[model samples]
Target: MPFKTLLFSKQDTIAVITLNRPPMNALNSKVYKELGKVIDELNEDSSVKVVIVTGAGEKAFAAGADITEMVNLSTTEMHEFCLISQDAYNKFEQLNKPTIAAINGLALGGGCELAMTCDFRLASENARFGQPEINLGIIPGGGGTQRLPRLIGLARAKELLYLGDMIDAVTAEKYGLVNKVVKQSELMNEAMAMAKKLASKPAVAMKVLKNTVNNGVEMNITSATNFETNSFLVTFSSEDRLEGMKALLEKRKPNFSDK
Candidate 1:
């Protein structure tokens, strides 16, 4: 299906989704609706190997939600709106395939939440980030509260959310909010390169590893170890694993039927 607020392309097994509103690309209900639909489509399509998300303009990946529209909603309506946004973003985060958020510029409030929802994040030197909902007498209603604490420590998450102050990309990297900060011109190229490398790997093994890492923190040591043990057994029995081993023995690149 076609999209109104997003532009999607496929290259070298990576599905790139660009937020095309430009000039900050503030997300609204329509953007969330389209995003939810697109994400569902990607999840259903086995042909797509990886997903990359970025904004169209140089000014911001997404400055935040469309505050002008948000201000008009009643409290109940606002809660419902936030729930909708969370559903869409959680879909991106919990996708079986890995996702990368390439922050080209300011990623504040909902925008920051969106990037945090991805499996990994890379930002440009010109990028900035914040959870500035408190500045408006509100708070981050998306997955910010949970995801932020998980990424950085709870103390740092509190400082950023409570202060509602913007931090530079370098600071964000230092605080472990982002994986890396690159030159503005090289951000997408670098992100795509990483995406391509990931796409080349066996799909089920990648997803299983993602689940293991994500679930590890929420589980006890013994439980997490059991999960890892099961995952190890599962991977050993997979066709991809056999193919990978055989390719090593054959001294050739593996042709992953993704079996």
Candidate 2:
């Protein structure tokens, strides 16, 4: 299906979704709906091994949610809007294939949360990040409150949320909010290269690895280890696992079928 708020394209096994509201790509109800649809399409497409999400313009990945649309909304309407946004973001978080956020510019409020939903983020040197809802007399309605602390730390997350201050890409990298920062011209290239590398790995193992890390982080060490053990055991029955071992011994690249 065609999208009004997003531009989707696939290059080999790598898929890219660009937020297309130009000037600032502010998130609104329509954008959320379109995003949810796009995520569903991508999730069902087996050929897409990796996904990259970014903004359309040079100024912002998404500056924030659409304030004009929110300013006049009643309490109940705002709550419904937030729920939609959360659902869209949750889809990204639960996707089986790995996702990379190419943060080309400002990532504030919902923008920040959107990037956090991805498996990891790679930012341009000019990119900026923050959860600035406090300035609007509200809190992050997206997953910011939860994911931010998990990605960075409680203290640092509090500082950004409470102060509503934007941090530079270098500072964001230092806080562990972003995996790496590169020149603006190199941001997409870097993301594409990383995505392709991840795509070339054993697909089943990669999915298991992501699940283990994501689920394990919230569990106690023993429980997490047990979960990892079970996941590891399940992989033993996969054809890719056998091929991987055989290729290692044969001194050739493994041709994983993602079985």
Candidate 3:
């Protein structure tokens, strides 16, 4: 299917979704709608073991939401838009395969929120991040208020949200908002290399690992530990588990079936 607001392509077992509203790839209703559809397709695709999301150009991963469209929206319309955007992002986050955000430039407001939905982020030296909704006399409506604190500490998250100031990629990495930062010229290469490495791992174990960590972090310690235990036990039933152990003993690479 064709997407008006994005570009989708697959490279071997890795897929890439590029936000395509060039000059700034601002998130809007159309972008959200297209994104939802694309995520659905990718989730159903068994061949795609990992996904990499980034902006079309170097200037921005997404500068922010489309202010031109939001400037005159009624309160009810705004609510609907937020809900739709949240739904789209939820799809992205819930994907069974790992997702990485390759942030090349500005990631502000909804852009920051979008990157947060990924399993992790890899940033370029030129990348900039912020939750600057307060600058527009508004606040983050797309899980920012929740996920930001969960990533960084409460105090740091508050500083960014309250001040609406942009942070350089180095500061973002220091705050643990991004996994790593590389030179601008190496961003895509680094991201794709990581994605390929992940794709080559035992798929079923990777999926279970992702699920365990994502769900466990939101639960109490006791419950999270029990959940992890159950997940670990379940992996023993998978064919990959047997292959993984057998390959270890045989000193050969495991060919996981994701079973």
What lDDT would each prediction earn against the true structure? Answer: 0.91, 0.94, 0.95
Q: Tell me how many residue pairs clash in candidate 2.
A: 0
Which lDDT tens digits does candidate 3 get at residues 52-98? 99998989999989999999999999999999999998998888899
Give model 3 RMSD, 1 decimal.
Answer: 0.8
Report the C-alpha displacement of residue 101, candidate 3, in angstroms.
Answer: 0.4
Candidate 2 per-residue lDDT, tens place, 1-259, comes to 6889999999999999999998999999999999999899888998989999999989999999999999999999999999999999999998888999999899999999999999989999999999999998999999999999999999999999999999999999999999999999999999999999999988888888888888898999999999999999878889999999999999999899999
Per-residue lDDT of candidate 1, residues 112-165 (tens digit): 999998988999999999999898998888888889988999999999989999
Q: Candidate 3: where is the Cα deviation over 4 Å?
A: none
For candidate 2, the TM-score is 0.98
Selected candidate, larger lDDT, 1 vs 2: 2
Q: After aligning candidate 1 to the native by TM-score, how far in Å is the CA of 218 from where it should be?
A: 1.3
Count the clashes in each prediction: 0, 0, 0
